[model samples]
Target: MTSHHPAPRPARPVADLFSADGRLKAIPRKPARREALLAHLAATLFEDGRDYREPEVNEALLAVHEDFPALRRYLVIGGFLGRTKDGSTYRRQQQPGSPGGAIFAVA
Candidate 1:
């Protein structure tokens, strides 16, 4: 008798969204992939736990795309970056499933 298991989903590489110069090709449509892509972009462009001024954040994000405001909002909304109430500063937040947290194992 043969035992069968469903195939596992292939790992999606978010890097494909970037051009050769490292600019984002476009914002993803699917929420999950979009969050993942945003997280990756935040990690690449911003330093973890570092405080960045409003203009500094824009400068970094602008390197990826012309729509800096949307990208900044996505990064903040995705829980990748924490913004001050006055929006003067931004800092990278620890990702839920990242190195410091439990990834796939059961609780």
Candidate 2:
């Protein structure tokens, strides 16, 4: 008997991906909204597995956050980024030149 693999499913449309209520049903987590936001920010801040400084990241999240403290805390606590001992801004936790390279999973 010949073996057969099913064809891959087509990607869903943007509108279809988000339900009528504008909720992401696929993301079944209590903090899905926060996760999504952090993911977006991480993507914007990083380039080729490396991290960026606070100003760059903050500019991206400026409109979304009214208070800088809260935004920074949220990202740090989520393990998306880390801060230095001194009074510096946020940086992505994963080091760029690491053996396994960079990685940011759902938190």
Candidate 3:
């Protein structure tokens, strides 16, 4: 006799985490999922070489979610975005093994 097992479900796309209006429904509690969300936000919201002021960053983040402050903090902490020593400017950090190399060290 052979034992039967159910097939595994495919992983859901990150885009599904957002609402129909493009706002994030909720922040993921899982570290891996959260990192993926942060990476997507960094890639889409901020430019690689451009520097953004705090207000500008907030504006962009606010477009996707009401909790802009938490998203901003997560982006910085995840090394997906970098801020100047004075915290006046913010820019997207390069991914590891990218052409120019990563600007900020990822923990």
Candidate 4:
């Protein structure tokens, strides 16, 4: 009698991605993959020369953004917005006190 066993299936490579720090890239918002993240953040957080608090900002971006300290730090270092000492608000650069800053708004 012939055997009834079936052939084994071929293995597929894992599409798993990772960051430089070896963190999982399953979040789907890597800088290399998504450069517009900060632009979106800037638009959502800034209003009338005012910035947003971490909680508020996180609420806005957390749902759609990946947790990247580099990106967050970039935003601050670039002077797109200034973080408050209390960590509760943001001040739009290039606003009233800013000599040369552009306004960001969601449209």
User: Per lDDT, what order, best first?
Assistant: 3, 1, 2, 4
Flag the better candidate by TM-score, 3 or 4: 3
Model 4 agreement with the true structure over 1-107: per-residue lDDT tens digits: 33563433232222234445544355334332222334444555566465566766555444444664544555565455688887677665542224433233213
Predicted candidate 1 versus true structure: per-residue lDDT over 1-107, tens digit per residue: 22353433345988888899988889877766777787787778888878999999999989888999988887776678889999999999888444533232212
Instruction: Evaluate model 3: give its TM-score.
Output: 0.78
The digit string of per-residue lDDT tens for model 3 on 10-91 reads 4557898899999999998876677678888998999889999999999999999999999999888777788999999998
* CA lDDT scores, all candidates in order: 0.78, 0.52, 0.81, 0.48
- The CA lDDT at 5 in model 2 is 33
lDDT of 2: 0.52
Which whole-number lDDT from 0 to 100 does residue 86 have in model 2? 66
C-alpha lDDT of candidate 1 relative to the true structure: 0.78
Candidate 2, residue 18: Cα displacement in angstroms equals: 12
User: Candidate 2: which pairs clash?
Assistant: none
Predictions: Cα RMSD each = 7.4, 8.4, 8.0, 17.0
Off by over 4 Å in 2: 1-29, 48-53, 95-107
lDDT score of model 4? 0.48
The candidate that wins on lDDT is 3
